[model samples]
Target: MSTFDYAITRTLDAPADKVWQAWTIADDYGKWASAEEVVLDVRPGGAWSSVMVLPDGTRIPLSGSYVEVVENKRLVMGMDVPGRDEPVLMNLELAADGEATKITLSQTFDTAEDRDQAEQGSNFLLDSLTAHLAA
Candidate 1:
């Protein structure tokens, strides 16, 4: 099998610490992890789960590992979305840029389908995060 990857970058008006908090805290992720509503179990081997319940309702569970957690700097993990049995690697970097934070997400998947799902899912989450951080 071949591997595929997708990446996205976002700049938040908030500081790196703030952005890191938003990404790490369950309560904060509940606010930013989706364009709608989501439930994230943000622990070492917990869940990276979600339920889209605004405009529509859908429940999707993803599996992963909190491979790395570097406070306000970086986070690396693995994820396997619904219907897929293989987990992909997800790396998130949070860097300070003056008064703002630059967030970059890179996802590596085992196949095209996995890559596609990651792209769609990550973009959705980014959109939600943008809205959440803006507020």
Candidate 2:
């Protein structure tokens, strides 16, 4: 199986703990993750799921599980679409940069095509996070 990875880093206007909370809490997550609704259980082995309502009212489901978690520091998860067999791995790292938080998000996909397919959505999600932090 072919594999590919993508990584993005952003400086958030919030503290590390606050940024972490934005990711681990369902309601906070929706403010940036582009989800109309979300359900996130942040502990290891816990479920991460959400439904995103598009502009045309189409709801897309995203589901995942936390494989590893370290509060305010790092989180890793196994993520995939409902009907897809492609394995997706996501890792998020947070660090303090003065009063701001530096966030690094990395994703690995089973195939280059799979990684390419998710590029736009991944960027959009991270961009939303940055905007949320600014607000």
List pairs with backbone clashes in candidate 2.
Answer: none
lDDT of 2 by residue, 51-112 (tens): 98766788998888999999999999888766778536788899999889888888877778
- Position 69, candidate 2: lDDT: 98
* lDDT value, candidate 2, whole model: 0.84
Q: Quote each prediction's TM-score.
A: 0.79, 0.89
How far out, in Å, is residue 11 in model 1? 1.5
Off by over 4 Å in 1: 35-54, 80-86
**For this target, which candidate reaches the highest lDDT against the unseen true structure?**
2
Tell me the spans in candidate 2 whose CA falls farther than 4 Å from its real position.
Answer: 82-87
Q: Model 2, 85: alpha-carbon shift in Å?
A: 5.5
For model 1, how does the per-residue alpha-carbon lDDT over 20-93 read when each residue is reduced to its tens digit?
87877767876666423444555566566544444445554444667677788988877665676766678899
| Clash pairs, model 1 backbone | none
Q: Among all windows of ten consecutive residues in candidate 2, which has the lowest summed lDDT?
A: 80-89
On the 0 to 100 scale, the lDDT of residue 56 in model 2 is 79
